[model samples]
Target: MRKKIVAGNWKMNLSLEEAQSLHSEINDALETSEFNCEVYHFVPSIYLSTLLESDQKVNVGSQNGYPAKNGAFTGEVSMSQLSGIGTKAVLIGHSERRQLFNESDILLKEKVDAALEEDLKVFFCCGETLEERESGQYKQTVIKQLKNSLFHLPSKEFAKIVIAYEPIWAIGTGKTASPEQANEMHKSIREAIEHAYTQEIAQNTSILYGGSCKPSNATELLNQSDIDGGLIGGASLKSEDFLKIIATYN
Candidate 1:
């Protein structure tokens, strides 16, 4: 079966003390809980080492990292640096990074390659804006993102990837795609992967839905045929809310 995962993008939120408290709560809860889905918290760069030092069951990752291993790129951390510090994953091509920082597909492709080189699992994100969605061209937009940035990889390297489909329009906007809409897009994504790779590869790929997902809506969304889990946002900041979403898989 494809891996079910619930990953939180803390997105520059939470101070060090708050992060510690939240992480502790999550760890303490998991100690008594039973669930099958993998759990991860993609936190700010500054708090990575500190949070990771704890024996928390939650997996930790960086929100962004440069493609270069070591360089004069001031203010940027390389994938090598993250991996060397025991981070097991990184989020690439998130809509905020694409919109705010102007990260082109070319650069994202390089980041994917670099992260995989260091054996870090890549949570590659792809989605469409409201304009594209209204125009009914959202499918093409999302497919183009995958083809441009991720399709270049060989199957072996691609196996380390987990695709997160976060509708740009719904993300942080308090809007969510109905379960049907999300599953339709997710099925389309799986078809695209099957065309590029093999049926087995497509079947095994874990495609997550990420757009204002919370405990209230997570059950319906996760119950969809194609959606395996979520890339949670606002709700993830709260330990109680995040754990509720995790229990959806059970």
Candidate 2:
């Protein structure tokens, strides 16, 4: 089965104390609940070690890491560093990281290469802005982004990655894609993978919808044919909403 997964991207929002509290709450819920989907919680880099020290029932990953394994780069965490700290995954090419830090596709591809070399699973993100969508370029835009950064990997390496389709416009605007819209994009992504690798790979890969996902809309959104799960943003900060979303999928 394609493992249905929900990953919470805690984006620069929690302190060490807050991280511990939220992690505890989430782990408690996961431990007590009977759900089949994998739950991965990603936190800011600074708290990775602190998050790992706890006995976590759910998976924990870093939000980002430097492309290099190790170097003279001061102030940047490398994939090796992440592995040493027990982080099993990393988010590559998140829209915020692309826009705010000017991370080009080339740069992100480098990050993906480095992370995979260290055997870290990747949550690779791709989507279009409102303008691109309005201009009818969203489909091609997303495909091109995938090709540039991800299609280069061999099927084995690609199999270890999760694709997150987060419509940039809907991400924090409280707007969401109708189920049809989300499924449409997800189908396109799956087709792209099929074109790059094989039909089996496309069918088995998990594609997550990540724009403003909440419990109220998650069911309808996830009910679509191709969307495997969610990459939750704000709702993930609250254990109740996040667990509710999982229960819906359950």
Candidate 3:
């Protein structure tokens, strides 16, 4: 079956103590959750050890990582190191990384390759900017991103990936892609995967919608045929709202 996941991207927000407290809160909520899906906390790199050491019920991952193993890259964490630290997953090509860090499709492909090589699940994020959407190139833009960075993987390696379609226009802007809009892109993503791999791979792939997905709109977005779950952002920092979003699947 396709994976159903709600991954909270706690991007560079919480300190170690703060992350620990939030993780504890989520753990307590999960005790009564009964939601039939996977949950992941994509915590900041410094807090990964602290966060994972406290919680074992839900999954945990890093927000980003370097493609190399161990090297002199001053501020980078390697995929092997992340895996060794018990990180079950890692986010590759999040828009912030691509935008702020200036990560290219070539660089992202290297990151994806390293993550999979180390047996880590990759939450590969791909999306279009506001201008691209306004110019009606959203579909083509996203497809090209996937093809250049992820589609080159062997089908088997690709299976370890979960695609999160986060339209740059909506993320953190409080603007959301209407359910129809999100589903349309999700269908296109799945179709692109099918064209590159196989029907079974496309059918089993978990394509998440990551644009302003909060409790208010998660239910409607998830109810669409192609959207599996969310790569939640700000709302995830709030314990109550995070639980509410996860509970939508139940």
Top-TM-score structure, candidate number:
1
Off by over 4 Å in 2: none
Could you tell which candidate, 1 or 2, scores higher by lDDT?
Answer: 1
For candidate 1, list the clashing residue pairs, or say none: none
Instruction: Point out the worst 10-residue segment of candidate 3 by lDDT.
Output: 49-58
TM-score of each model, paired residue for residue: 0.99, 0.98, 0.98
- Candidate 3, position 232, lDDT: 98
Best by lDDT: 1
Q: Which sections of candidate 1 miss by over 4 Å?
A: none
What TM-score would you give candidate 3 relative to the actual structure?
0.98
Backbone clash pairs for candidate 3 read: none
Tens digits of per-residue lDDT for model 2, 1-250 = 7889999999989888888899999898888878878999999988888888878787999999998777899999999999888899999999999999999999999999999999999999999999999999999999999999999999999999999999999988999999999999999999999999999999999999999999999999987999999999999999999998988767
Off by over 4 Å in 3: none
RMSD of each: 0.6, 0.8, 0.8
| lDDT tens readout by residue for model 1, 1-250 | 8999999999989999999999889888888889888999999999999988988789999999999989799999999999999999999999999999999999999999999999999999999999999999999999999999999999999888999999999999999999999999999999999999999999999999999999999999998999999999999999989999999977
